[model samples]
Target: MKTKICGLKSLREIEIVNKYTPDYVGFVFAGEKRKIDEEVAQTLRRELSRDIKAVGVFVNEPLERIAKMCEKNIIQLVQLHGDEDRDYINALQSEVEAPIIKVIRVQSVNQIKEALTLPCDYFLYDTYSQHSYGGEGKRFDEMILTEVYKEDLSQVREGLQKPYFIAGGLTAQSISLLDNRLKPFGVDVSSGVEISGQKDEEKVREFLLAASKVS
Candidate 1:
């Protein structure tokens, strides 16, 4: 599975993940525990290798700010994880050069059905309930994902389909199912690797290694 390390903060952590060579390195542009400021993001952008994509995570940020951050940070990918609608997303896509990944909170079958209608470069399936929108670090009912989770690769490649990144509460225990059989475009992880609000290198390494073992 292509891996994306989100909630990234320190240069040391980003450098550690480089050995694993994760496909995407994300910076939290909003929310608590956000390690860096706009200036930090700009600096980190230069340090990131061309091969490794950079993503900016925003939670219902103003369009002007989002546009500015994307430019200032030089991030090429945008992951929106809030109540942003199609118009907001479309506006960003039109303004920014980066591709947009819309996060869909999976709570029930109906939510899944509605997710397919969103216009985005990628679809992120995350845990959601009455309380939050995304990044809660708790899992939703995986059984609800059974149909699409088990669907064949060919079926997943058909129309209205976009790349998939399974997010929320996925750790070593849940990484195995993301093998080729599952055919997820990538995996998105955050709190699963934390010890106490900081990125633990050992946990990060193990998570990557375990996920890499899947056939």
Candidate 2:
């Protein structure tokens, strides 16, 4: 199973990622406590190991700006955690070479159903948040996935272009809680891996180790 560590802001966090070496690391361009500008993203990108892919988090950002970052190799993947629709995704796909991972904020099963149809490289299922797009460290009822799987397991597995990641308040224990039969493509953690409002080395390592077992 792939593992993604999102909302990274500091060089220290980048260094921690380097040590743990998750499949994906995120740079939030979207507004939040963890948001970073393009310059900082570039520096972090440079600091990141070649093996770890950089994912740029955006919310309703201009297509050109995102495309420019992709073209310049500042980010290898684009994670859209906004109100971006199919039209927006279509426009972005035409302009950039980087793969897109659309975020589906889940408050209900209907939202998951809706997200299944979006044209993107991958889908990230996260908890619904009124005040934030994601990275709020709040988890939704993971049983929603069980409901989806029960409804029509084969269809969701086959129809989805790629394996999707589960995000929002994920911890080592939470990762262990996932049903073995319904494993996600990956698991994303941000605040769960943080200690005292910052990414902690031990927590990062622990999270990665736990995720690896399931992956």
Candidate 3:
């Protein structure tokens, strides 16, 4: 599986991912403690090479602002982790040059099926949180994902699997544990790869180190 490290705050963190060369790097654009200002996010995104995809994670953000920021930062992907409608997602795609990633709050297979209709370049299966949307550090039942894999996984693999980035409570051990059964397109880490709720460079390096072996 590929790897993506989220909630990046500094150029140092970005450089870590760039040196390791994870498929994608994510930045949060909403919430109080979690949200990153547009100026800093844009500056940091500028430093990323074009080959490495830069993602902006948004939760209930206005479409107009999202389009503007993505354009300003030259971000390649937008990861939506809120209660956004299909039309809104489609409209956003029409307005921006970059692609979209519609995050599904997977409580059941039916929720996974709902993602099939969304207009997105990628799909991220993250832990559903009542409080936080994307980087809550909580994991959903892997068995739920396993069951989905057993059924229409081939379809997912054939279509969107290449760019699919898995999120929610993933660590080195978890990546190693999951490598055998579910070889995903990519893996995304936020809080699980951190120390004391802040981004840990060693944890990030070690997680990517483990992912390189599995992916």
- For lDDT, the strongest prediction is 2
Candidate 2 residue spans exceeding 4 A from truth = 153-158
- lDDT of prediction 1: 0.76
- The stretch of ten residues in a row with the least summed lDDT in candidate 1 is 151-160
The 10 consecutive residues of candidate 3 with the worst lDDT sum are: 154-163
* Sequence-dependent TM-score of model 1: 0.87
lDDT of 3 by residue, 124-190 (tens): 8888877666647777877776666666554454433535667888887777777366657788998
Q: What is the total number of backbone clashes in candidate 2?
A: 1
Instruction: Give residue 72's lDDT in candidate 1 (0 to 100).
Output: 72
lDDT of each: 0.76, 0.87, 0.76
User: What C-alpha lDDT, on a 0 to 100 scale, does residue 53 get in candidate 1?
Assistant: 89
**Model 1, runs deviating above 4 Å:** 148-160, 177-181
What's each prediction's TM-score?
Answer: 0.87, 0.94, 0.88
Residue-pair clashes per candidate: 0, 1, 1
- Superposed by TM-score, candidate 1 places the C-alpha of residue 52 at a distance from the truth, in angstroms, of 1.5
Clashes of 1: 0
Candidate 3 stretches with Cα past 4 Å from truth are 153-162
Error of 3 at 81 (Å): 0.6
Ranking by TM-score: 2, 3, 1
lDDT of 2 at 153: 48
